[model samples]
Target chain A: MDKKKPKKVFVQGAIPPEKIANSVANHQSKTNIGAHSIFLGQVRADEVDGKTVTAIDYTAYEEMAENVFHEIREAAFAKFDITCAHIYHSLGKVNVGELCLFVFTSSAHRRIAIEATNFFVEEIKAKVPVFGKEIFEDETHQWKVNK
Target chain B: MKVTVKYFGLVAEAADKSEEVIELSEVLTASELKKQCLEGLAITDKDSVQIAVNQNLDDAITIKDGDEVALLPPFAGG
Candidate 1:
C-alpha cells in the first residue's frame, strides 16, 4: 500500500476556536469511528516576578519540526488501534487564553482515542523544537521552557 | 569548509542574529561548533543548548561543508 500522506499541522497564528468545530464536522462522514478525543493547549496568563504574561511568540525550526510531527503521528498509529489522528499547532504570536495546539484522535473505542491523543501531546511537548517567547504586559519578554 | 549555523529562541536572542555562515579549515563535532558559537554570546545555560547538524540533533556527529547546523534552546512546545 502507498504511504499515508501527512497532514499540514502548523497554522500561521493562534488557532481559532471555530476550527475545532469544523474538524469535528469534517469527521462526521467517517462512520466507523465510534469515539473521538480532542486536546487543546491554551496559553496561560502566567505571572513572573510581578509581571503578567500577555502573549507568547512561538517559532520553530520548521523543517525539522514538521518531520518530528510526522514521526509522532506514525508512532501513535503504530502504538494504538486508532482510526485517525489530527494535530495542529500555532506559529507566531498567541495571546493568553488562546489556543496554540490541538490534538484530535478517533478510534473504534474511547480508550484508544484518548490514549493516542495523550501520546501526541506528550511527544510534541518533549520532542518538537518549537520555542516560545513570553511577552509580559509591560512589553518585556522572557523565554519559556517546558518543565 | 563553510557551514550555515542557525539559532532559535533564547539562543537567537543572545546571538543577535538568526543565521550565519562560518568558514572552517577542519571538521568539528556539533558540540565543538556550538561552544564556538556561544563563546561571546550571553547564553548561560550551556547544558540546555543542543546542536543539530543537518537537522539531526546529535552532537557526536561530525559537521561537514555546507551543512545546516541549528543551536536550539530548551523546547517549550505544548
Candidate 2:
C-alpha cells in the first residue's frame, strides 16, 4: 500500500493550494501507474452582455447531488480499467477564472485515463443535481448548470 | 390517490423545496395534473414546464390512481 486510498468521497469548497500537491502525490506514489490524467474546470471572466463574470455561486440539491456523484464514480470504475478516480467539485463561491472541478484518473495505460476522465465529467454535468449561479460584475445573476 | 411531486431548479425555489405530496380525487392526464399543481400554488397553469410520471418523462399518458407524478421546471442544469 504505497498509494493513498481515500475512504470518504471529497465534495468540498475549492481545493486549497497544498491539497493539489497532495493529490498528485497520492496518485503517483510507487503505484506503478503508467498514466495519470486530469481535467480542471475554471470559471470564465468573459463578458456577458458587457457584464463581466465576477464569481459563481454554487449550490446543490445536496442529497441527490451526493448520491448522483457517488453513483457516477462507481459507474466509471466499472466501465474503465483505472485503479483509482477522484472527483472534486466546488461548493459555495468561486472567484473568476478559479478552478471549480478537478477529476483525476490513474490507470496502467493512457487510453483508459483519457476515456474515464471524459466519461465522468460528462455524466456528472448532465446527471448530477449541482447548479451554479453566475454573478456578473454588474450584480445581475443567471442560474445555469456548471457544464 | 396521493402521490409525491418533485420540483427542480428555479421552479423548486418558486414552489419551495423539491418533494411534496398532493391528493387527487381520480386519475388525471399528465396535462391536467399540471393544472392541479398550479391551482394548489395559486399560479396560472403554464404548459412550458415539463412533466414526468413515476420518474419517467411525460408521454401524454394518462396517470392512474396511486401513480407518482413529478412536475419539473425548465432545465438549467449544465
Candidate 3:
C-alpha cells in the first residue's frame, strides 16, 4: 500500500542512538519483513589544516527539502519491492561522533532491502537542499560540500 | 512581477540575507536573474550555484510573476 503522505524525516539536533533501538523494537509485529537494512551517518571529527571540526550546524529550505524527500521516497518505493522504509536526518547543530542520518528499509529479502537503502542514501546526498556548516574548535566555520 | 528570492548556505552568507521579495520590472530567464543576483556577491564559482524557479530545478524556464526563486549552493546532506 502506497501511503500518499510524505513522512517527516527531520529531527532537531542529533539523532539519539536509542531511537534506532526503539525503531527496531517497534517493527517487531511486521513478521513479513524478513530483512531490515540500516544505514547511519555520523559526524566525523576531521582535522582540517590546524583546526578540528567540532560540530555541524545543519540548515535547509524546509518546505522544498520536504517536497524533495517525498519525491525520493516515492521513487524508491516504485523502484524497489520494499515492505516499508524510514528515513531520518538531523537539523540544527549535531556534535561530532553523533548520528546525523538514519535510513532503515525492510523487505522480504536481503537484496531488496539493502538496495533500497543505498538508493535512498545516494538520492538524498544529491537531491536534498540541506546545507551544513562545519564548525571548528576555534569557532570558525566552513560550508561543507558533498563529494 | 513580484517574486520571492531565497538564498541558502554560502549564497545566503554572501548575500548577507536569507530571503527577499523583489519586483522584476522586466522578464528574465532563471540564468539571467541568477547572473544579475551574483554580480556584486563574493561567490567565485558561478557554475556551482543552481537556480530553482518555483522550487523546480529548471533553469530553462522563463521566470514570471509571483514565482519563488531560490539560489541554492551545493547540497551537503547525507
Candidate 4:
C-alpha cells in the first residue's frame, strides 16, 4: 500500500455499514497483516433539558481538517508498527444511531493495531477542526464540544 | 491589504456569514485580526475561538494580503 499518500477521509453523509465490510474485504490480499482493529463512532440521542437530540449536522474547515488528518496519519505510522490505516469521517447531517467516524488499523500483532486505532481516534477529536451541531427534536440546536 | 476570513461552526453562525474579506490599513497579528473580526459578535465564549493563517493554527503569525484566515471553534470530531 502507498502509505505516504494522503487519503480522503471525509464522507458527505453518515458512513454506511457496507463500507466497513468492503474495507475488510479489500485487505484480504495483505497476508502479512495478522491483526486488525476497527473503531466506529455513532451519534447518540442525548437529552438536553426537555429536548432530545435527533441528529448532528457536521461542518468543518475542510482544507485544514484534511491537512491535519494527514499529519496525524504520518505520526501514527511513525509511532506504530502498523501495516496500514484508514480513517473516515462524516461531513453532513448524520442521524442518531448512525455512524459518523470509522477507523481501521492493521498490524502484524494485535497490540500495535489496537493502539494505532485508539491514537487515531484521540488525535482526530482533539486536532481536527470539525464541528458538530446537535439538533434536537424541536429543531433547536447547540454546538457540541469534545470533552 | 485584504485578508479573506473564513468562519466555521458557532463562529459562522454568530457572525451570520461564512466568509468575508476585510481591508487592513496596517498589518495585524492573527489574534488581533481575530478580535477585530469577532468584535460585537453574539458568541458568548470568544476566547474559545482560534485563528489559523493559511491553514496553520498560529495566533502569532502576521496577517498578509490575500492570506486565508480561518476562525475555528472547539472541535467535536471523533
Error of 1 at A136 (Å): 0.2
Model 1 residue A54 lDDT score: 98
Candidate number that wins on lDDT, 1 or 4: 4
List candidate 2 segments past 4 Å from native. A1-12, A145-147, B1-6, B16-21, B28-78
Docking class of 3: high
User: What RMSD value applies to candidate 3?
Assistant: 0.9
Model 1 residue pairs with clashes: none
lDDT (tens digit, per residue) of candidate 3 on B1-78: 899999999999999999999989888999999998888999878789999998998898899998999999999997
Residue A59, candidate 4: Cα error in Å is: 0.6
Better of 1 and 2 by TM-score: 1
Q: Per-residue CA lDDT of candidate 3, range A4-101, in tens?
A: 67889999999999999999998899999999999999999988898999999999988899999999999998999999999999999999999999
What would the DockQ be for model 4? 0.96
Per-residue lDDT of candidate 2, residues B1-78 (tens digit)? 777777665556668777888787886888888777765563333554566776556547788766666665433332
User: For candidate 2, what is the DockQ-based docking class?
Assistant: acceptable
Q: Score the docking of each candidate (DockQ).
A: 0.95, 0.26, 0.93, 0.96
**Ranking of all predicted structures according to lDDT, beginning with the best and ending with the worst:** 4, 3, 1, 2
What tens-digit string does per-residue lDDT give for candidate 2 at A1-147? 312333343455565656667888866664778998888877778677778889877766555556667778778877988878887888778887677788888889999999999998888777665667788977888666442
* Candidate topping lDDT: 4
Q: Which candidate, 2 or 4, has the higher lDDT?
A: 4
- Error at A140, model 4, angstroms: 0.7
List pairs with backbone clashes in candidate 4.
none
> What is candidate 4's lDDT per residue for B4-77, written digit by digit as tens?
99999999999999999989998899999999999999999999999999998889999999999999999999
Mind listing the fnat for each candidate? 0.96, 0.18, 0.94, 1.00
Docking class of 4: high
